[model samples]
Target: MQISDLPYTDPGVPDARSGPRFLWWLGRNQAGGQLKSLAWGLLHFGGVMALPYGVGFAVQAVVDRSGGRLAFAGLLLVLAGVCLAFGDTMLHRTAVTNWITAAARVQQLLARRTAHLGSALTRRVAAGEVVAVSTGDVEKIGWFVEAVSRFTAAAVTVAAVCVALLIHQPDLGLVVALGVPLVALGVLPLLPRATRLADVQREKAGKATELASDTVAGLRVLRGIGGEELFLDRYRRASQDVRHAAVRSARMWSAISALQVLLPGALLIVVVWHGLGLVRDGRIEVGELVTVYSAVMLLTYPLRHFEEIAMAYSFSRPSAKRAARVLSLERTTTGGPDAGPVADPAGGADDPRTPPSGDLFDPVTGLLAPEGRLTAVVCGDPDEAGRLAERLGGHAALDEGDVPGPSVRLGEAPLDALPLDAARAVVLVQDKDPVLLSGTLSELLDVPASGNVTVDDALTAAECGDVLDALAQASVDEDPMAAPITERGRSLSGGQRQRLALARSLVTDPEVLVLDEPTSAVDSHTEARIADGLRTVRKGRTTVVCTSSPLLLDRAERVVFVHEGEVAAVGVHRVLVRTDPRYRAVVTRETEEEQRRSGSTANSTDAASPNGSGPVIEIEETA
Candidate 1:
C-alpha cells in the first residue's frame, strides 16, 4: 500500500486465535510492501558487502604497481559508494513506510471493532488495556513487522559473504563461516527468560496505567472525600512496581545485548588470528587476508540484526496477543432484521404471520409496557432494574448463539432476533450516569438526524434552560451552547450534567425510550417538571422509565412495581399504592424524603394528594 492510502478502507476480519497467527495475518495483508522492503534491504546490504571486495582489489592493484589496475579499482570503489548511498536511503524509506502502513491498518481495525462493539467492548476489556493495545501495542507490532525484511536481508548477506570468503581460501573461510553460526545462536538460551521478564514488565505497566486512568476519572470525588493522598500513595506504589519490573526486564535484555557484542568481538579476533597464520603458511595472499578480515568486520553489523529481530519478536508477541483478545469480542446478537415485510406462505405480498403491534413484553420479569404510553417501573433493587433495562436493549445475552432465555419482545417479534441496528434505533436506553463527551453543547446534541426532535425542543422538554444558564455563567460568551465542556462534563455540576445528557437523548426520539433514573441527580422540583415534560414531549411513543420518584411515577400513565426480579403489580401510581403494600412502602419512602426536604407534615401531604405523589413543591434551585 502507498503512504497516501493510509488508514485502510477495510482492515478485514482479523485472525485472533493467537499472537503469532495475528502477526502473520498482518504480514500477509501487506505482502507487496514487505517484498519491496526486502528488495531494498538486499540491495543496501549488497552494496555494503561490495565495499570489502573493492578494498581487496585496491590492495592487489597497489601490490602490482599497475596504474591502470589502481585506476580501475578506484572507479569500482566510487561506483560502490554511490550504490551504498542510494540503496541505504531507499531501504529506510521502504521500511518506515511499511511500519506506518501496518500501524495504520491495525489502528483502523481497532477503531472499527471499537465502534461496532460500542460500550460492550469496555465491559469485557479494561479501558486502559484497550488504550494500550491501540497505541503502544500497535506500534510495537508494526516495529516487528518492519524489522522482518531487514532481518531477511541480513541473513542472505551473511550467506553471500561466507560463499565469497570460501571461494578465496577454503581453510580460512571454513573457520570464519563456522564462527558466524556461533555468533547468531549463542544467545538463544537467554531469549526465553528475557521474554518472560518483558511480559512481567508489560503486565505491571498495564495495571499502573489502569490505576492512573481510573484515578484521574474520579479525581473530583477523591478530593471531596479527602482521599487524594491515599489514592496518590496507591498510585505511587503502582508506579514503583512498574519501575522495578521495567528495570528487571532491562537487565535481562542488557545481558543479552552484551553477549551479542562480546560473541561477535571474540569471533572477529579469531578470524584475524587465523588469517595471519594462513599468511605465514602461504595458504592465502596478504590482499586475501585483508578482504577476509574486512568481510568479517562488516559481518558484525548484520549479525547484530539477529539479536534485534529476536528482541522485536519477543516484545511484539504479547502485544499482538492483547490486541487479538480485544478484537475477538462480539456483540450478543448477530443478524439484523430481514428487509421488507414478512411474506405469506401463499406467495402474497402481505404476510399474515407479521408480528403483532402492542406493548413491550419481557418474559423474564413478566413486565409489559403498553404501546404509545409512558410507563414507570419502581424496583426495590436498583441492580434488578438495570438488568431489565439492558434486556430491553437486547444486550442481556453474552453471545449471538447463546439462547436468550425469557427474551424481551417488541411488537410481538423477539427483540434479540431483529437486526442490531434496527433494534437499537427503535430502543434507546439512557443509563443513570450518562457520559457527556468533551464538546460544545451544540456538538453534544448533534446525533444522526433520524428523529423529528430538534436540539431546542429536547432541551425544552428536558427542562434544561436552568442548566444552560448555569453553564453560561462561566463562559466569556453569553451563549451556553457555544461554551466548552470538559471531558465527561466534569466542569458541570452533577444535576447540570444529568440534564444535558437527558437533553441529548431526547433529541434522538426513538420509538422505545428506556431511561434508567435519568433525573436521579436533579432535585425533586426539576425532576417533577422533567417528568411532566417528558410525558408531553414523548406523546404517542413507548417510554419506560426505571425510577422510584413519586413525582415521576405519578406522572406516568401506568407504574409497574418490580420485586425480587419479578413484576409484582402494575397499575396507576395512586391505585397501586393503596392496593399493594410493598408498592406503598416504596413510594412512601420517597414521599417521606420529600416531606423532610420541604419541612412539611406527612399526614397533611398524604391527605392532599392521595395519589402518593406528595406535595407539588416547585421551588427553583441551582444544580
Candidate 2:
C-alpha cells in the first residue's frame, strides 16, 4: 500500500490472537510492498557479498600475470560497484516506503477502531496508551516489519558466501563456516533477559505517558484546587521510573552489543590463525587464504542482522500486542435473536418507529420518558446521575466477562438491537463534560445538519451569541465562526465552551436528546435563557436533561428524582421541590452557591464601574 492510497475507507479486520499473529497480519496486508523490499534487499546484500570474490579474483589475476584474467577481474569489480551503488540506493527507498506504508496501515486501523468504539475507547484504554500505540508503538512495529526482509536477505547472502568459501578452501572455510553459526546464535542465551527488560521498560513508559496525559488534561483543575505540585510530584516519580527502566533495558542490550563485537573479533582471529596454518602446510594457496579471510570478514556484516532482528522483535512484540488488544475491542451491543435491523433515520424524524424520536425507557433506573416532552432527571449523587444518563442512552457498561447487560429500549425496540449507527442517530447523549474539538467555530458545530435546525438557530438557542462576540473581539479581521479554536476550546471561558458543545448537539436534533447538565457552566441568567431556548427548540421531541438547577428544572415538563440509583419521585419540578426534602436540599444548596457567586460578581462590577453606568445581571430562582 502506498501513502496515496491511505485513509482506507475500511481498514480490514485485524487478527488479534497474539502479538506475533498481528505482525503477520500486517505483513500479509502489504504483501506487494514486502516483496519489493525483499527484492531490493537481495540486490543490496548480493552486491556486498560479491566484493570479497572480486578482490580475491583480482589478487589471483595479479599473481598469474594474465592480462585477460586481470581485465575480467576489473570488469567484475566494476559490475559489483554498480550493483552496490544502485542496490543500496533503491533498498533505502523501498525500505522507507515499506515502513511508512506499514505504519500508515496500523494508524488507519487504530483510527477505525477508535471510531467504532467511540467514547468507550478512552474508558477501556488509557488516553496515553492510545496515543502511544498510535504514534511511537506504530513506528516500532513498522520498523520490525521493514527489517524482516533485509534480515532474510542478509542470512541468504551469508549462507551463499560460506558455500563459496568451502569450495575455494575446505580447511579454512570449515573454520569460518562453523564460526558463522556461533556468531549468529551466540546471543540466544541473553535474549530472554533482554526481552524481559524491554517489556518492563515499555510498561513503565506507558504508565509515565498516561500520568503525563492526565496531568496536562486536568492542569486547570489542578491549579484551581492548588494540587498542581501534588500531581507534578506524582508525574516526576513516574517519569523517573520510566527513566530507570529504560536505563536497565539499555544495559542488557549493551551486553548483547558487547558480545556482538567481542565474538566476531574472536571468530576473525580464529579464521586468520587457521588460514595461516593451512598456508604453512601448503593445503591452501595464499590467494585462497586471502579469499577465505575476506569472506569471513564480509560475513560479519550479515551476522550483525541476527542481533538486530532479535532486538527489533523484542521491542515490537509488546507494541504489536498493545495494538492488537485495542483492535480486539468489539461493539458489544448487537441485535437480539428476534430483532431485525432498524430503518435508517436519514430521511427525517417522521417515523415514529425510530427510537431517537420515540419514547425512551430506562429499565435499570425505572425511569420512563414520554415521547415529545422535556424531562429533567435529578440525582443527589452525581455519579448515579452520570451512570443513569449513560444507561438511558443504552450504554450498558461491560460486565466482568466483557458482555453488555440489558439495554434500554427506544420505541419498544432495544437500542442495542439497532445497528450502532441507527442507535446513535436515535439517541444522542451529551456528556456533562463534552469535548470541543479544535477547529473553526463552524467545524466545531458541524454535525449531520438535520433540516429541522440550522447552525444559527442552534447557536442562538444555545445562548452563544456573546461567545461569538467575544471571539470576534479577539480577531477583528476574521469571521468569529471562521476563527480557529484551541484544543478543547481552552482559549474560551468554561461557559463559552459548554454552550458551544450544546449547540453542536442541538444541530443534530436527535429524536431523544440525553444531556447531562447542559447549562451547569453558564450563569443563572444564561441558564434560564438556554433552558427556555432548549424547551422551545426541542418542542414535541423527547429531551432528558440531567440537572438540579431550579431555573432549568422549572422549565422541564416533567421531573424524575433519582435516589440510590432508582427513581424516587416523578412529577413537575414545582411539586417535587415542595414535597421531596432531598430534592429541595440539592436545589437549595445550588441556589446558595449561585447567590454567593452573584454577590462576588456584583462587588467586582461595582469596583470596576464606579459611575454605575454598566448593567449588572442578578441571580434569581425562576421556579
What are the per-residue Cα lDDT tens digits for candidate 1 across 1-623?
88897767787888987899999999998899889888888888888888887887789789878788888878988888888788889889999998999888889988987866655566568988998999899999999999999999999999988987887778778988899999999999999999999999999889988888889878887998999999999999999999999999999999999998899889889988988998899887777888888888888888989999999999999999998887776655533455334322123236564333468998887788989999999888887887788778765435323454655777766666655665676678887768899988888998854467878888998888987887688677878888889899999878888888888888988778899998888889899999988988899989999998889988998888877776767778877765455566677764656555655444344434454333222111124
Q: Give the total clashing residue pairs for model 1.
A: 2
Q: Which candidate wins on TM-score?
A: 2
lDDT of 1 at 411: 71
Whole-model lDDT, candidate 1? 0.81
| Pairs that collide, model 1 | 336-419, 337-419
Candidate 1 to truth, TM: 0.85
Q: What is the C-alpha lDDT of each candidate?
A: 0.81, 0.81
Candidate 2 per-residue lDDT, tens place, 14-52, comes to 898789999999888878887887788788888888887
TM-score of each: 0.85, 0.86
